[model samples]
Target: MDSQAISVEILKWMLEVQCKEALVPALLYEKKVRSQYGKAENVQPVKGVLSKRALQVNAPGRDIYGLEKSTEVRYFECPNCERQVAGHRFAAHIARCSGRGRR
Candidate 1:
């Protein structure tokens, strides 16, 4: 394989799911990036804002229960069917659900 092809393969590997979960955070850490810290240690957020991010960013593996729910999965209730869906799939699910004539 040519050098360009090898580089393309490297990029594709980086984009894989497991690769992304590992690589992205490592890259961010290399750059000393942090989602929360310091002075905000005790600042109270608005009622509906993200309050758990600090726990996540600083303590990624604290979910020793090892269940899927223990992961940082975002959940929301669909207003129409009231089905709880993960935040990542909420939009597509709601659209399909509304098309089914329920919402």
Candidate 2:
């Protein structure tokens, strides 16, 4: 391994030792290592089917906001400031833009 990889592995070992000795919280060590080194290159992401319990509990449906999912995003150009605003927020944008003096 190169110097940088070696250093990261050494740091990980030190963090684990500190965690085992109760000098640092296990959660903190996990968070620090994750935030700094990210995922290990040797580990492969597992792809599998979800459990029946997970499927039942996490059944996909309309979001809590009750708005149906629309994949397409539409943009409208503001006549006053000539800024492109998202379709959902266009009304509010127009109100604010129209209230101000045109450049």
Candidate 3:
């Protein structure tokens, strides 16, 4: 029929022939040709069968220190001043200071 159907038939015949050693080289060549010019879909699973979902239910939250849920601002030690400053404002303040230093 179509190229896809033909490819699938060829694959099935190859498997039935027990051509394992030839399969790898054939697959590699197929991949190379597909990479340059797209190939056709060959195999199709049985109809009316739904594929399994990839995502998991009841996944853990990303709270490393159990503080991610907290509303309190996290503080970080400033490299230039060695003082504790709010994490959010630290970078902006550092940029301002550096810009002032350059003037």
Q: Report the number of the highest-lDDT candidate.
A: 2
Arrange candidates by TM-score, descending: 3, 2, 1
Kindly give the number of clashing pairs for every candidate: 0, 0, 0
> With candidate 2 superimposed using the best TM-score fit, by how many Å does residue 84's alpha carbon deviate from the native?
0.5
What is the C-alpha lDDT profile of model 1 across 32-94, one tens digit per residue? 644444233565678766546554655645543432335578899999899999999998888
TM-score of each: 0.29, 0.31, 0.31
Which scores higher on TM-score, 1 or 3?
A: 3
Weakest 10 consecutive residues, lDDT, candidate 2? 59-68
TM-score of the candidate numbered 3?
0.31
**Candidate scoring better on lDDT of 2 and 3:** 2
TM-score pick, better of 1 and 2? 2
**Candidate ranking (lDDT, best to worst):** 2, 1, 3
Ten contiguous residues with the weakest lDDT in model 1: 32-41
Give the per-residue lDDT digits (tens) of candidate 2, residues 1-103. 8999999999999999877888557668888999999965785545796655555555566344544556889999999889999999998888778775355
Candidate 1 clash total? Answer: 0
Clashing pairs in 2: none
lDDT measured at residue 89 in model 3 versus the true structure, 0 to 100:
90
